[model samples]
Target chain A: NAGVTQTPKFRILKIGQSMTLQCTQDMNHNYMYWYRQDPGMGLKLIYYSVGAGITDKGEVPNGYNVSRSTTEDFPLRLELAAPSQTSVYFCASSYGVGGKAFFGQGTRLTVV
Target chain B: AQTVTQSQPEMSVQEAETVTLSCTYDTSESDYYLFWYKQPPSRQMILVIRQEAYKQQNATENRFSVNFQKAAKSFSLKISDSQLGDAAMYFCAPAFFNAGGTSYGKLTFGQGTILTVHP
Candidate 1:
């Protein structure tokens, strides 16, 4: 039941140097998301959480910063990294709002 | 503010033939949900079918099917035997249940449809 578990997976930051793209989920989901896939562009909503310490700001949240403190983590922070902050970062979970959304096997950031 | 339109950026079928991938949406929010995601190049975002705006009954998952035409809001995806692992890159997501703020489980996606299964 490793539903959604994203980690380094791949990275290459340099522009401003800063990284943190790790998501976790064991299905206790309370709806957590952070997406950004930009090469044919299809997934872009970069911050969300609806439980433990709630956080929000999606639709490509600026430079990105998120934290859900508990309930199977949801971390996506790229403090200063630019170059349009690279791309391909996804982490999702759902068990509410009409559940069914679980993805994560991506985190291919490359900000050179 | 809801928008999801996948006017087929790409599509190809042959292997067993039967491929229909097209989605359209625009909602002012009336309790919604519709999805079809499959990004395979190992990008892994697979959740091939789901739809329920008020449930007019149109959602399947064996040979994969969905043709919900909620008053022409249209949600289409039908892949019947065409499997070369069913190619990849096909997404049309829209999950809007914003009763006010904290918009519940927000998801809005489009600009995807690249399925090519030709053996």
Candidate 2:
């Protein structure tokens, strides 16, 4: 089974451009999250959703947005991308908050 | 707010040898969870092991084991018989409750410790 899937394994965007990082999970989990990892750094939370239609901002939510329309999908949107937004983005899902999370392979985004 | 710390930015170990990565955290919550996730060159975050604050017994998975010191709020990972595949960036994460009753499931991650296995 495909535990977690992230589309566009790699992408490049010019400054002020916008794009969406798609993430879907087959585990039927209730919790989903978006995180970005800079080189040699740990993952930083960008957004999270406890369940469908319930989303919240995270530590690094300045240039990102997220929506959870269904239990299977949680997509992250990067608007007006900046150089600081260039990093590897990851999507994760968990049965619930504080539960073990299954992470996606990651999408490497570069903003020029 | 909770914070996780990994003081070691990099660590090296001879193949077949054992290495320990240290982690410390700060949190007021009495019940929570700690985890070690490994991100290899593939850039996939994989769960190495996990420990629940309320559980006295440490968690172990295959060649990986954790030393959980609740009082000190420290969680260290020990890898036995280190293999080339074990070389990766290790992150210590602590999960805690937010102001809202809903669980954050959000993780406070450390700066990350890079493990290098030398043959």
Task: Give the TM-scores of the predictions, in the order they appear.
Answer: 0.36, 0.96
Candidate 2 falls in which docking quality class? medium
Query: In candidate 2, which residue pairs get closer than 3 Å at backbone N, Cα or C atoms, i.e. clash?
Result: none
Q: Taking the tens digit of each residue's C-alpha lDDT, what string does model 2 give over B9-108? A: 9999999999999999988764678889998888889998988888999999999999999999999999999999999999999888655655465787
Q: Candidate 1 residues B1-119, lDDT tens each? A: 78898998999999988999999988877678888888988888988888887889998999999999888998999999888998999998978886774568487899898988878
Segments in model 2 whose C-alpha atoms lie over 4 Å from true places: B98-103
Q: Which 10 consecutive residues of model 2 chain B have the lowest summed lDDT? A: B97-106
DockQ of each: 0.33, 0.80
What is the Å distance of residue A42 in model 1 from its true position? Answer: 10
Q: After superposition on all CA atoms, what RMSD does each candidate show versus the true structure? A: 13.8, 1.4
Docking class of 1: acceptable
TM-score of candidate 2 chain A against the true chain A: 0.97
